[model samples]
Target: MFLLLFVVAFALTVNSHSYHRNKYITSANFFSGTIYSWKSDVVGYFKLKERNNALAEENRRLRSLLAEARDTVPFIALDSTVFPGPYQYYPAKVINNSYSKTKNYLTLRKRIGDPIEADMGVISSKGIVGIVNKVSNKYASVQSILNTNSKINAKLKNSFHFGTLVWDTQEPNEAKLIDIPRQAPVVVGDTIVTDGKSTIFPRGILIGTIKDFNLSNNQDYYDVTVQLFNDMTNLHHVYIIENVEKEAIQEIEDVEVKAPLQNRPTESIEETNQENDAE
Candidate 1:
């Protein structure tokens, strides 16, 4: 009789436990879901800045495309050909940047197939940034304009005179434009821009404005100080410029340079002796 009573009591206890479980299951799930959603909202809030930066980059890309469509030019000589859209700009985030040192450098996050390579020009939305020095499959390093070894071709905006842009390792915002012919009119506060003399930068890209100028030591040129547009100490997003015709132009130049030597008649020993005899 005692065993029968114990079995009956155990069956009643199990049924009671099942009833309580079914009653609380819905509430338990609701609470868990609410907590998860709250955590996700917090995470998203913290990511707003990154999202804004990405949007800004996209806008700049659109502007670049529009500019390309408006400025397409036919092929001409290497330097004279207006590269309209010959350059492809790739947006990259500045993963690391520095300007306090004399030789400042920047690192960007980019992949191998992303159209970036060594010697590519880098620029910000406001103005020039740096040039790509090295690249890996997923990253690139840039040599900042603040470097002592950095030199770029620049010119006065209102005239045809051009000069070489260099840094003095003295100030972050100031750079020197040397070799400008003194004949070219120069005044303080005049605009300076890229001369497009090289394959790196396009003509008229704003570099800076003249802060001061003086006759160079050689007295044949003017040395001008330029105040940069972009703040080198603070950089976030940048564009990497890839010249589509760089390789083709380089190949053509190589052929043209080698053609003269290859076609010139080499002087034989007999010819040399005759020339010496004539002298």
Candidate 2:
């Protein structure tokens, strides 16, 4: 009889208090939400690799389409032969990267069987990354643009003035552009791009924007600071660019021409005077 009376009192107390019922419902919802969140996180983690692969493949396809579109000409005749473009791109994963050294390098997961070769240009979606220095059957090493020895031909996007791109080892995301003649117009926030002087990188490939500028000690040219688009410390995907005509162009340039002193043309008096005056 005592146990029955206690049970009835407990039930009446719970039913009389709306706070107790609301607290019970809130606790149950919170516990379920946490469980669902954990489950979602685990599933997402497992699908990460798949998602990345899909994204890379999609990018490759789009790049190929763009290349083809650029190669195409309006009102051109269709032929059975497909002429290859001057540049070809191959996607690769950056397995290792280093940005905190005077001479930093990156390692890529490309094998010897791949069409990649030394001196080829490497770029990410945002901007230039580095150049391939060494390639083995299992991997390839890149000389990062952040390295002290890195140099590439870059130019002002709005003008034809070109300069040499170099790193000062002071900052990973910043680089220096030297040898820009004083006559060229320069302003902060101007875009810099590859000059297409070499067969490696094509013209108009983005390098960075001008952050600051000053005349060098000699005062013959301007020294410009560039802020890179890519975060050198964090990298994952990159594309290796191969110049299809690089070999042909290099071979033609390698042939040395020699002329006997007797056959060499002499400078005219007027030309000599002009050269002296310019000097």
Off by over 4 Å in 1: 1-84, 256-279
**lDDT (0 to 1) per candidate:** 0.75, 0.77
Worst lDDT run of 10 residues, candidate 2, spans 19-28
RMSD of each: 22.3, 22.4
Q: Which candidate is the best by TM-score?
A: 2
- Give RMSD (Å) of candidate 2 vs. truth: 22.4
* TM of each candidate vs. truth: 0.65, 0.68
lDDT of 2 at 38: 56
Candidate 1 backbone collisions, by pair: none
Q: After superposition, how far is residue 110 of candidate 1 from its true place, in Å?
A: 2.2
